[model samples]
Target chain A: MPRQRPPAIRIALCLAALAAGLLPWWNAREMAKSAFPGFEVTAPSAGESGEPAFFKKTVVNPFSPHKKSHSASLVRMEDGRMFAAWYAGSGECAPDVAVYLASTDAAGNWQAPRAIFNREKAMADLGRNVISVGNALLLADGNRLGLLFVTVAAGRWSGSSMNIAWSDDAGMTWSRAQNLTMNPLANLSALPRNPASPLAGGGWAVPVYEEFLGKFPEVLWLLPRGGGYDFAVSRVAGGVSVMQAALVPLSRTDAVCLMRDFRPAQFMSISSTADAGRTWTPPQATELPNKDSGICGARLPDGSILAAYNDRSTGKRENLRLAVSGDGGKTWKRVATLEEEPGFEFSYPSMVCDPDGTVRMLYSARQTQIVYVEFNTAWLKEQEVLQ
Target chain B: MSTLTVFLLVVWFFQRVLPVRGLLGLGVSTAAGAAFVFIPWLGFWIKSLAPNASIPMVGLLLAAILGRACNKSVFRPADWKAAWIFGAAASLMLYPSALGLGAFDTYSLGWPWLFHSVSIALFAGVGVASAVLLWLGNRFGYLLLLAGLGYLAGFQESTNFWDYVLDPLFGAVSLVALIAMAWRSRNPRPANPRGTTAP
Candidate 1:
């Protein structure tokens, strides 16, 4: 099997074989899904290489730095080393908090965790709203790390904005944390994005959600300017009422923003732009199934779309799930449960597919634990089975 | 499946099986299960409790008591050592690919350790499920096995466990093991009664 075949032939054959074997997967297709021309999904038999399993765990408290910890995000670097960070809180949503780090070998085993950045200064400078820095992250070219998190500058869970941090040495040392917000708002998160993929100007979008007056979520493009996050926000909406927006990149000139109505059980609104993230049309309600639950959306390379959400407007956030959009964001069919019953709280789920094809999903349910799932273009392309 | 079909399925399954009481049982057991997986310190304790799962774990206590009353040989044991061989081979093949070996990569290229750990748990769950399904008769067993598998592909994955949970490997291994066991049983050679067989 190894010697008889030329190296290139073998490589091409394997790729072709996988692409062919995964014929059942439709994500490779475009237009009507039957339009897929080049690649096919190659799902290995269960006992084969595609089998699904857990990677490894890092308590983040490996150093037992603080008395508590919660809300973690993981990133696998170019070298196959896994880096994880989380907020160490004295209690759920507590003020005495700081984000920490841990690394894993290629096999996924975790190393001891350390404090990538502390909250004492941010907490003192801005008050305790700067709880922990990275509940979400954006890793960039040249080994830069971008993170955003929520903190209360005013009241509990009240004040939130974006903050950015980085480590050239994977936490051996990190640059000092800086705020990503233009001015302080209620809350913000670095909307997750794929790595090694370019942005409009080599900068990435840090999703900021506001709470005060007219405080809404905006897609803020952050470029690594002058060794800090030089940030700018796109008006996700004029009113602070429009919040919990889902973003998807269609092309260099287009992006989709799915904004939701402030009222519960209402239709989710959409605001899209043909000129990249510069501007978006006014949001209107859509028939997509969103149980007033928060939603996360992403664009598949095949032009199909994926949204993480609940079925009805009132399903438990942990009852949250995945839905696919075959025709842009026009409609969606519920795909799979991001988290199910026994763990009925997988909320605020963040998803990103790293360059190596691993899809990372992070969510906080029953106390801020991240549940990650991965599949090739093949698995996702399977005829969706909705609930 | 359509939304209506799934809605019906959920209603039917939940109405029939997920009673308030069952929900409570699920809650308690699930919490226990989560502790068993997430708390690394308790792994040995759980492993020691479920050794020799010749039968699956769910039915162990009942099966032990019933073993004395029931006839020992339900079906002639087959020569089933092949199951282990297939299982080990499958493991060797899939394990490396998952561990970022042999240039075959699925997810887990970049992920947090918790995500990786959880991905392993999902596959492990699929493994245990397929094993139990194997004894429940073949046609429906394959269906349950697929459901177990679907649970796996549905989640982002990590490199851990045998890349496969319940799969052709299970069927292949079971076939071999059963055949080996039957061959041994049909030609039972009297050991020197010391519980050792060399002949």
Candidate 2:
């Protein structure tokens, strides 16, 4: 008879094999309960006069024009307090870049910018040598706040990964950062741009993008876990020419994603999902012009889709405008021009509609500071009338 | 990065980058751990190589190197050939679609609840493969078990099961090894010397 292995080794290998098979299946079962049953637009009651009630634009971080500031995101807490976050440093890919957070008082006064995350903090949290930080995205889950930002350890932005940290008592304190494993290849190239939409069950439908060998839009489904949350990445649409998806929830089981186009002279790419985020239609070009810049979209109180992006057709990011879509995101009309300097840059606009029917917008102004804007439906209507 | 992954990176630095090769398995591992704690630049260099590696792949390489150094090796030449074949096959199936070469992405199957049919099939395949490998007492069976356990334990940041099993580095090395093996088989050396005939 052939020599056989020891019975104990055989039994141990069998047990390990059983464990290897059973564990991922158990995790899969647990993850199956995390449903992305689409998102719902939760706008406040809408009845306002067209007399332009409140319209204000202010810089969130002023003075320090030498330092670069870009990609600001906004979130309104359950107590009606608003917070804004953006990354600022020497330059775009400089190692000194850090994510800054600023909160507004009840009276709408913006606080000074504070560095919440940086390269050293990322190195400590991730046990890796981070090269830089970019694109701070803030989302509010009831009272607690979640901030998802980008960290680059090697290569360029394509070599970045998304790290998330939560603050229970607003933006004062935060949990240690946890990296979201997005890619199988080196876990590279997952970046966040716009704010997240609240899912039906108890999660956030965050729109992130991949930038490794190709640029594509992906939706990060975040389900609440103990202090932080468990996350899964779902591709919104796969292509090499579109990224930075801004999600606008149309119904409880439907949503539309608007993405930035990397192809030159191309319009904004749009895709729709009917069965939550399980599947999406092929992305197609929209009517709005995109010069490879970040854009944000939100469903307005009056059942209109509002998208903010650089209005230039084929050139620089000098002009930024807000366009409203009546029939979903099929067609758009430019209602207001937020920034229109010929040579200066005013791009990467992030917008959110507050609970009290107030519309807030934030964008990078001249790459020097983040400009904050607040308005009402009445003011938006007035702009439409003027147009 | 996991603690084990950090330790493995340091071990990799010592095994592949350093000039010292006369140490035992335990000695190398201990010195690598000490260097990681006492030295900062060494940690930075090791972590800088992270974007090209995965935890399980690092563990596998370290295990083989340590087994050889300890003189209690678990893998034979045939076992390494099996590992190379598995790595090469997995890389060929995953990389092209994952890098966006096709309409359907193979990487999406790694995520849960997104592709129901594909995920189910993949799970069943893994279960069956695990059973067969364990039945035959293959050393790669242990590697698969460790990868599965590490993925389930959430040892690393990656949620993908494939990230715990294979990376581009392992795939590339396996492909190169397979090609070399094929070339060697095709062009074998003669047993007799140039001026003498076989007795």
How does chain A of every candidate compare to the true chain A by TM-score? 0.70, 0.92
**DockQ, per-model, please?**
0.01, 0.43
On lDDT, the leading prediction is 2
> For model 1, how does the per-residue alpha-carbon lDDT over A168-221 read when each residue is reduced to its tens digit?
765676555554423211122223322212364355554444444443555555
Candidate 2 chain A weakest ten by summed lDDT: A43-52
Each prediction's whole-model lDDT (CA): 0.44, 0.77
Q: Which digits, one per residue and each the tens of the lDDT, describe model 1 over residues B1-199?
A: 1112222223323333443433454444344444445454333222212111111111222222222224232222221232343344444443333322322122221111212332333334334434433433222223334433332353211111222222222434445665676698899867676877462
Model 2, range A164-193, lDDT digits (tens) per residue?
Answer: 888888777888888777766767788889
lDDT, model 1: 0.44
Which runs of model 1 end up more than 4 angstroms from their true locations? A1-76, A91-93, A110-113, A121-136, A184-198, A224-229, A354-358, A381-387, B1-199
